[model samples]
Target: MDEAVKFHFVVDGNDFTSAGQASVQIKKNLRQLGIAPEIIRKVSIAMYEGEINMVIHAGGGEADVLIYENRIEIILTDNGPGIANIDLAMQEGFSTAPDNIRSLGFGAGMGLPNMKRYTDAMQIDSTFGKGTRISMTVNL
Candidate 1:
């Protein structure tokens, strides 16, 4: 592709049942484009993790996917309580989810770690009490 193809999705924070919709749609779109299954899987997993984090922590967020010739970029932005410590949040098994969320079998403290693990590149921009913006990329 000579130019990037873009897709935008709005995550509904109030609905746990629809949390992974964006990731699922992205997976379908990638498949239709004939993207490799491995690449699609990586993007789906990363996007899904980010989506769940937004729902459980941020209250909601917007996700944007940009498809490029050499890479795919996923951007998730939320206007909820921002992460206080990026370093700590990146650590595996370190979670701030409440008991209720954990009871739902959703908060395992692995969202950020898993997102980073599946993507080729990842960056998180967050301000305490303000918001967060995470950008991740997967090589094509």
Candidate 2:
């Protein structure tokens, strides 16, 4: 690609049924763009984890994917309760999701860690009461 291509999505927090739609769409888009299978898989997994986290905690959020010649960038932003502790939240099994969300099999606290694992780089900016924005990149 000579120029960056961008895709934007608005996540719906009220509906668990629609939680993964964005990630699915992204996967399709990446595939259609002829992205490598490994890169597409990484992007899909990372995006899905971020999308689910937005639904379970952020009430709703915005996701943007920018496809560049050498890398792809995924940015997720939400206006819900921000993460209280970045270091703690990055742990494998720690979660702050409510009992109801946990009962629904959505929140296991692996979201951030998994996102990081699948991406080349990940950055998180959060305010306790305000919101959070996570930027992740996957090199091509």
Winning model by lDDT = 1
- Model 1 off-target regions past 4 Å? none
- Each candidate structure's TM-score, on Cα atoms with residue i matched to residue i, is 0.97, 0.96
Choose the strongest candidate by TM-score: 1
- lDDT per residue as tens, model 2, 80-129: 99999999999999999888988888678898999999999999999999
RMSDs, each prediction?
Answer: 1.1, 1.3
Output the worst ten-in-a-row residue range by lDDT, candidate 2: 101-110
Model 1: per-residue lDDT, tens digit, 1-140? 37999999999999987899999999999999999999999999999999999999989999999999999999999999999999999999999999988988977889999999999999999999999999999998
* Deviation (Å) of 102 in candidate 1: 1.2
RMSD of 2: 1.3
